[model samples]
Target: MSDKPNDLQKIRSVADYQFGKGVGEKLFPGGVKIVHSKRTGRIRHVYLEEKRLATLRPTNGLFSLNIAGAKRIMKHVKPQRLWVRVREEAEPFVARGKSVFAKHVIDADEEIRPQEEVTVTNEKGKVLAVGRAMLSGKEMKAFKRGVAVRVRRGVAEEVKKETLTLV
Candidate 1:
């Protein structure tokens, strides 16, 4: 017979490996039932009955609510900020050795507000620069013109410019 504590530890390890550290605790704090099948490697889906899902929902079935609306509904609950780590690089471009703009948009926190200070990082999570956001999360999603972030500090890489032609 196998020990219950040993079995629990093995399960926790597998959950952490699959979803990342603290994910298991966030998703299933009480505990979860794991089903292993030959068709699916190790574990398939994590199941939370409808009751559990309902408890997580805010009004009717909405997970997203504005700050004021959320406060009114869940007075006891505090708003939590979620950060997503992204892998990409953004470098500021200069024209005639004068800082002009950024070459690319690195990983973005979709919840970032305009004029907020944000940390810009490369694909390896290395801090490249810090700057103020010029656009909102939605605007950044479809931005095609104007400066997105005005870098204030850190290394800036130069980009090769193509010769312009007048028609």
Candidate 2:
């Protein structure tokens, strides 16, 4: 019983350290469910009822943000974590479900590393997609070719569901 609460606290702490302040609270609201693996009993998924928010990587034990989690965190935190900002010209394409190109990236969080999960946004900070970073932030700004973010999910109407239902 005590272990469960402690585990949840550790998860929240990790989210705060990884993303930013207030992000954990936003993503893991009260009543959020932490799904554990059947074999290992380790947290495998974080969910708000039926909406999956993130997955805990078994190799590194780090949380990888899903589309729903990205959207939730984007609403609370500024674009300073693992975030990439693209030009308005790229908004339509990104929102329409396309990978972000380095040529279109106007700015990005300097802390972003290659292969890390990131959220792509427009100039005004509208989240367009959640994806994995293909290049470092410096590389994304310096290079004109190559993919910056390999979009895992896009901001289509189907993706933007309403408030998460508590489990």
Which candidate leads the pack in lDDT? Answer: 2
Candidate 2 overall Cα lDDT vs. reference?
0.82
- Which ranges of candidate 1 are over 4 A from the true structure? 1-103, 156-167
Weakest 10 consecutive residues, lDDT, candidate 2?
A: 158-167
Give a tens-digit lDDT track for model 1, residues 54-119: 111212221211122212222222232221122242332211222213335543667767665444
- Per-model lDDT: 0.38, 0.82
**Pairs with steric clashes in candidate 1:** none
- How well does each candidate superpose onto the true structure, as a TM-score? 0.35, 0.80
Q: Which ranges of candidate 2 are over 4 A from the true structure?
A: 1-5, 157-167
C-alpha positional error of residue 96 in candidate 2 after TM-score superposition, expressed in Å? 4.7
What lDDT tens digits, residue by residue, belong to model 2 across residues 16-116?
87777767777788878889999999889988877888888899877888777888887766645888999988887887678999999999888888988
